[model samples]
Target chain A: MKARLRNFLVALLALAGHLALTSPAAAATADPLPSWREGPARQAIVKFVQTATDRASAGFVPPAERIATFDNDGTLWTEHPMYTQLAFALDRIRELAPQHPEWKTQQPFKAVLDNDLEALAAGGEKGLLELVMASHAGMSTAEFEALVSDWFKKARHPRFKKPYTELTFQPMLELLAYLRSNGFKTYIVSGGGIEFMRPMTEAVYGIPPEQVIGSSIKTRYEMQEGKPVLTRLPEINFIDDKTGKPIGINTFIGRRPVAAFGNSDGDREMLEWTGAGKGARLMMLVLHDDAEREYAYGPANGLPDTKFGTFSQSTMDEAKQKGWIVISMKNDWQRVFSFQPETMNPAKK
Target chain B: MKARLRNFLVALLALAGHLALTSPAAAATADPLPSWREGPARQAIVKFVQTATDRASAGFVPPAERIATFDNDGTLWTEHPMYTQLAFALDRIRELAPQHPEWKTQQPFKAVLDNDLEALAAGGEKGLLELVMASHAGMSTAEFEALVSDWFKKARHPRFKKPYTELTFQPMLELLAYLRSNGFKTYIVSGGGIEFMRPMTEAVYGIPPEQVIGSSIKTRYEMQEGKPVLTRLPEINFIDDKTGKPIGINTFIGRRPVAAFGNSDGDREMLEWTGAGKGARLMMLVLHDDAEREYAYGPANGLPDTKFGTFSQSTMDEAKQKGWIVISMKNDWQRVFSFQPETMNPAKK
Candidate 1:
């Protein structure tokens, strides 16, 4: 009788241990957005997701209709020290300077080579387009992809001293995964070059190439040396910024997004489009107000104006009027990036 | 003893019944492409899929990289008796004829209204663009979707007396399902307008709106009577035909497709692009040679030339040289469409 009682006790203990081990996993799933601190911003996101996903709710959005778009630059990662793509272009221009000696005399090229910020800014949109055309074009699609992938491996953020891929916000990553867990199809709708983003989005942001919609230069298909090649052309195809954001979204996605996240006025149209849709919706702006952790910007915090990703006073007012949630990075996020500064190779700086 | 013997007999009978019912289901799964008749075309497809999917095979492709693209018009459905979009445009013009009295005197409009195919063809690509812009634009995306959905419900084919949605090929449907089952992501990359196809693709071909890439018109986001609207503008965006096929595929998908299927010269570049990729690839062109079942128009089998979807001699010669499979519809497909003609409404014709 004592032996049988011992066996029963052992079985009960094993069952208790198993339940203890698995309970946290169940709790973890219940709290999908763990990185996000419990606040109105997080609450709004959670509420929208619950209402959208709940079958019995009047605001229930079908699984197929759950389209969510996120802007990459300031919203997902550090776009402050400079826009990541712009930094890449600058690096590319410096590498290619030896091939084009005339760049020494050219205004914008000379500005880029000399690292003259004021001169480069003076060149404005036209000058930026010229730089983009020079650095991004004149290669096959396959070659360009390889070059971008290689750069991503070596390039480190100037301030963070970490790989640019590691600079992605942990809170935003959690949000993306959380939304996806609830049957939402997440897309990156950015003003950045489509090809530039496609190489790394799947790895860094969990966004597939087909789900990314962005600006692009013209690419021509030709038979080169008996092989089919898509040669990038030095011409403007589409610019997916400002009003063009909605156009790009419409052209590529064909369906209006139910949720949009951004950090600048460039994303205003995308948010408006998302908000316009009937029923439950989510439109958010990440207000960078933590200079101690991440770089602070926008008209709200009295931070210096940035040409890379501007958040003017008007944009803040629009967000306020439209009831779009303003996410405070300092207060809302438990962790800013996926990596710590000391862990990275400081010598890469 | 008698009761025990009876129970054993019942158990034996139950096992036999279960085996009899399940054997066909097991066999059906073993043969994935059932609608495709046993021939070289079907064999080539199966071989490519097997090699690409097998982990030990040299041509093994990862699931994420297993992308397959299909052309919609001639390849998925009947493009003869005029392209479906053109038919839709013509019908729309007639419906809006009272609102646009000037269309009575307009060159292309007059040609369409009079049902003069020769005159419309003479007006060429420019005329078609004008007609498309007039019919497809000036409405919100939602309104356009509703209009398209309504048209699909009411519009009957001239010869088949069936809705265009029901005219999709059975063999191709089986092929799509087969590819998807084997962990391939299927997309429709066509020359047809993106908006026009998105409404029906999900219902007819099991492809969602986001997976459909095609030509588009510019749409602007605006406020109309205090409600947000995306107004379609009358301007050509990207065209996804001929050389544009590869460009569109590169722009939208970013990854090169492992298998591409089409039925015309418009798909030549796309097939070439797919064929150029390393390892096991399947490039197929559907030859419309069964006049009794479907329309036949190509440079092969003494069929008449067609302006809509031309499969020219050069395209055929290239396919031969490249070893691309030319699918003979008459020989390879046991059935053409999903439905029979007798089941459709004859009076609608």
Candidate 2:
């Protein structure tokens, strides 16, 4: 019996050696989340996730109920001086400006046509909304999707001169995929138009249209060629921005996600909803502090060049009190946009 | 260095001895998904999932985009004779029936009051829709939710004489949690009213309202007490049953799911959409084939005691050809509803 035990021990040792040999060297190391910097923002995120996932932890959320929501324009990707969608729309305006002579004469369209970023930014939400309505609305959902798809393939960021999809933040992209791998459903809740987003959302955000919650225009089901087709109408359906984000989420999804992320104060309600829930929740706000890496802007003295809405002292205070994570773009991320080094020549100070 | 290695090895051996001393003999393994029986349907599911999750296997799917959709009602829980919502509504009707003398004169209500389920079933979708609209519509979303929650607490299934929520299959409940642990997002795409499903969805299915896609009545945002309130209207919004399920999924979810489940032909399109999509997908259908254990029903010959929509053989053939799994309740599940033994008296053969 002792000899048999010795043989069993020898076999176990041999098996362990085989496993060690087959495993990659990198697989054995304790690596933190790849793009995460070592600090409170990172620490808070890691700690929250760890507790939620650890079976022994007090805050352990069942893996099934682990739902995470992210804002698209700024939180998940780069929303600089203006949203990427606005930039894309502006480019479309330029491309179609000559065809519609009235655009050259119109106030907002003329500003867009003249390449007057200052004057265009002066329009604010109302003016910008009008521009979006004129340029984005009126077309059928399918046609609009096709147009956006074509534009995405060809349109390049004016400053970065890279494909718009490539402008997505690499760190956040990795984080989204990582969270999903760890049993979280990542949804894109943005202020961008729903139709404008659906075309590229799957490929870029790894979130499909159903998971994408944004501003929407009313649509109707119509029979075209003996088959039912959804047609986008010019009427305002639901605008899922600002305080509307939470309301939209509640209306569309019907569940308050455990984890929420955003860049601007527009996302304040969503973050509050996420963190204020009964069980364990994590809310993150991305602060674009690195002007050279991306545009730096908050509520104070709004720079027309700054794209995202704004992050306030009130929001920051709430973040602190509620144990919400505030990610400093300047410090918290080793890498910013996916197009870094390749497309963006970091602006000279 | 050799002496230190020997000491470490000795310590490891001691630890192993301690582990063996503490470890209890393995208990007889219970079926993890006890509601299912041992059959081809069960085998197909286990085999497909195992192969799909195996990284080195040919069918390995990257874990990030694993999304599964399920048809509620018969697919996940019981939707016999009438939907569970209708059951709630009926209970509400009976409780409120004393208050409204007008219901005594109404056709469907008259049938309901008379306990003529046969006559009520004869009314079909149109009649059921009318009944649902009358009982479920014209209240604030919150009010409706409260009503649902109130009904859930008191309402019991007529046959089983247990709360309807308690009748949910235990194995399916575990499967939902298990799939989520394995990086799958479980969504309910049902034909029931969205609001009707939302109130109890989180508690019962571990799925929130946002994850639920169902038929809906029109609603509008109204400012009530200086806050936005969604007021449910008495008009049809989106119907999410039969062909509507696929359409609802397409419009609301936007992405094709990696997996889908349903019991009847109403879920045929949803299954087709998932399995026929590009890349890896798993589709399943629950077959109610055990009369002794639970109700056995299909289009050919189903339970006369209870009735709902049924599926055809062609649909089963299609599922077989497309590699979709069909789970037999009698064969695959070891246990049926969570309330089994305690709540339900197993039908004597």
Candidate 3:
């Protein structure tokens, strides 16, 4: 009897949340996504959300099953002056250099301290792992979170000259809001450290800590002065990238996503897993074609490629072959960040 | 521009969900938890929810942070005679005995096949891991879920003569609903396998699969006939018991819970982690003192201890010292299960 009542109660709450977005006062506007220009990419997203939420439509999905995942790096914010996490690590190395004199001579540490990007890139994943272990662990979760928040207070994006939090794509923020209004739970499925992202996600993306799934290090529970603390351990627990992206999604969220968006090869598996679900799915890859506005380096346009967020030719080919929508930044978005002057979407103003 | 709008939109939706439970028609009832008898235990819960949700009160917690976690085996359902998972494992061994004739001679398998509970008890944790690996892995996640569903269809609790799902505590179910009605997001953080619990959590407890966190085995994503499937491997990825409880909560939920409930020492860290957080917190343990209504085995009140869900004397003492509520099943609950006749909660009558 309680279970039945509980289900009814939950359904009512879900319905209330759903109604908040679909109500006339909220979504009655002619253009739900004003920043999205008139293009197939914009049309695909708008159409999918409409069809999926319409109870009379065959594509209608239950409110509880309306889960959508977004890749964090280049997809949601800037990852191109280097992946934001990599930049954080390099800055951390410099911050701690005075305390550790030996780091000046250490191979990877020396490269970072010397500001030699070429030498640091040459050290590859091994070097990056070393930097992450040094910078991201060996403290209580509370302390780590405090450190991250402190860093974010002063850390400015090298290219945009704006705070990292401010660099989040304004159009994407609108989509997240639109999805939530329609009862879709938006989650950040990222390769970045989970701890690193949780501190700012709620402020920047409106995604609270629990909805973020990403790479993690092991944490241990210890008693300090008769108080419990979860201490971070410098061991890799799970990596949420490439094939790991799908695994992370499946493990963290037991439901398959109805919509997924990403920008690079690292997100191909996530898009594949989401598209494989039986329904009207919206799978999109953001193409960084507008170097004039944002960073663009991918094999898709014969641009110079970097190890960070690689958009390979094969992944581009697969997106076409599998019928996934490719979002062209230069054409589809009226404006990338809200700070910029509105490009004025052709369909609007 | 969109960020401010998104915040307003999200706040509106959150308010809508909150009002669903607090509405006159829903919360107008005199007692939200009817199965809870008159006592300090019941009073404490009522007071906590009232204060926590009261915006004018200092104890008020935001809806997003109103996360509650519950332990599955003992707290939510009966765990005596042996855990439900243990029963499943032993039954699985018997089901596969025809194919693996070697099991007719193997140690733990022989013990299970021979119907010798004493020998199986003597094998301990190592032997149990072997049984779990043998039965729970070497199949796709989808296949494992189907197997779990099939088992639930026929498997009955030995003492109750009802399905395991039907054995959940009525008062606890009421508590779960009461919390949700007040805008709390309840989660199951159990020592049981994640896949094993997810198949039935939504139906039995009104908790969805994504909200359930538990022990897991390694899973690798692979392409099977051009379709993606996650294959469960025969290696333990995590064990969500003992100190592991806090780690699992932190790793998956990323927020310390405002409330936590459990029945054994395995949940000590989780409770401690929760209580350590600032705010009005409710940490509770279920004491099964009603031998007539359900199985009672613990160190408390001279009850015989068992390997499954052990309630240690030290943990009982610590609960008192820490001011965590210890709920006596005999004294507090009006009825154990929904199918039972109402004992007529003293205050209600």
Candidate 4:
């Protein structure tokens, strides 16, 4: 009886193995919109995307017309305290300072080297522009690209201590992918220099260099030793900020985006332009609110000395009145930066 | 006896059905490379491509790094008598002549409108450059893009009377596809304006706008009513001709192509650059030698007015010695142009 039982068990096991081998195990998992924290804003966005993508839905748009524009600095990634490009430019200054003796005694450069946040902050746009121009200009586009690639490899953020690219919001990456899968041709329409963003945009954002519309510097072609060269000029060619965003988009793309995203008043025109378009349009603004997970300070909500600041409530009120999607970072996102792994343990102390 | 007869009839019918299904008589006829005449040159290309692409062979390079650069104008399509862009610019002059009254009285414009090929050609480089600059510049990038899209729709080639894009070489298109299948990133490094090439590259060559590197005009960014505008300047920018070809390729792509193809000495530098690179480089030149089948041309054999005339026997010898693949149009190509159907039949009547 024991021998019979053993033989029966072996036969069953063989049958199970045969069934498993013959089964269609390579079936792809269905990719749905990732579950966002349940809320009215999330619901509206989900509904819009679903309706627009659905063939049977009344709000359905043709795949060819499904263009979406996204702001990179704040909407797609964390831009707290200051824009990431500023951070990159600042780090570049430090790396380059040793080569130039004058910078050791320079006002802004000295402030940057000394880590005097107050003095650097006081420098404002004029100071920042000088810092950027000194560090970013002069290199050939190819040289600049290599420099950026090198910087990305070594530099880490002051607070997060993680690579700047790693600080990109996980939820936003999912949204970009979701939008793409739904037949949207996503673009980065921002105030960033076109060349500066072109180097890393493809790897980090999946947006090609050509699709990135931004501010640009004047370039001239000159024949040096019978070979043509593209030289970058220090002159300001275009400033893609505030109201300039919409016009830049219109001029470059020749068509209006069906959806737009932004985090500050700088992107107000882009959102306004998208919302003004006919038929289906979706616009969203990311409001920073989590103090523990992320630094939070709106014009009305933060401590006087806090570095983080937000747009006036009037802008949020305007967004609400316009039926725009205002995402509350604290309430909507399941997680912030995707690079942070799920579990963290202190090294055996 | 009846049962035996019925069984015999069933067997005979079954045999007939099996033969009908299995035999070539019931199968579709295969397509031959119809345009290609039987020749040793054609045989060599076909055999080499087949051997290289075969997975069983030792020489299997992945498609991503299979960079193939082709010269525009003559190599891929017909640019005989006059370059295609020149024709477009002349037509543009005529279109804009009414708007600019001065053009009607002008030498080049008058010649263009009057259909005097002699007078138009008389203008040479000075007049041609001026005409091109006037017709091509002063518009926003968007306006120029729209103009191209519109012009392509209506303009017909003077010789073929078909759309210029339709005049592309059919065999080359097949070769491009075959190369792509085997892992090649094809690019058109042309002497044409970058903006001019971009509007139609995707539709005509299947090359994305960003992949095309060519001559360009300086553009400036201006804030017009709060929007950034990229204004095309009248000043000459990069001239991607002669030695500039290789330099442009290096600047834009940051790597040397493995394979390069051209039809003229304008492509000499490009071919040289490709050959100079280490390891398994393939450089081919399309020698136009079939006047009967297409247009006959060589620095020694055809068209005196051609920019570099044609390839000389001594030049051909040097190319051969350098291990370059010289594709004789008369021998290698199956078809000269994609519009052969129209050429073959003037009318159904």
| iRMS (Å) per candidate | 13.5, 8.9, 10.4, 18.1
What DockQ do the predictions score, one after another?
0.31, 0.19, 0.36, 0.08
Fnat for model 3 comes to 0.61
TM-score of chain A of each: 0.89, 0.85, 0.90, 0.84
**Which stretches of model 1 miss by more than 4 angstroms?**
A1-30, A341-349, B1-30, B341-349
For candidate 4, lDDT tens digit of each residue in A1-349?
2445445544545544454445454234454534355677677777888888889987788876788998887778777777777888888898889898898788788888888879988987788788878877776655777888888888787789988888787778878888898889888887877777777777898886656877766555454565444456676766777766775665455467889998777787778777766777899988777665555666533433333324666677778788888887777766667654423212111
Interface RMSD score of candidate 4 = 18.1
Arrange candidates, best lDDT first: 3, 1, 2, 4
Please write out the lDDT profile of model 1 over residues A1-349, one tens digit for every residue: 2445445544545555455456654335466676677789999998999899989998899998999999999999989788999999999999999999999999799999999989999999899989999999999999999989999999989888888998898889999999998899999999999999999999998999989999999998888999999999999899899888888888788888999999998999899888988878999999988776788876755777877678888888989999999998878776778664422322222
Candidate 3, superposed: residue stretches over 4 Å from native: A1-30, A344-349, B1-28, B344-349
lDDT, candidate 2, A1-349, per-residue tens? 2545655655555555555555575246565466666788778777778888889977888876687989988787767656778887787778777788998778888899888978887987677877777777666566788889998898777677888788888778877887887788788888888778888888898887778888876665555664445566666766787667876777677766889999877887788767656667888888877777776777532433244567877778877887777887777777687545532334221
Name the lDDT value of residue A17 in candidate 1.
Answer: 47
B40, model 4: CA deviation in Å?
8.9
DockQ of 3: 0.36
Q: Each model's C-alpha lDDT?
A: 0.87, 0.74, 0.88, 0.71
Name the best candidate (by TM-score): 3
Identify the superior model by TM-score, candidate 1 or candidate 2.
Answer: 1
How close to the true structure is residue A312 of candidate 2, measured as C-alpha lDDT? 77
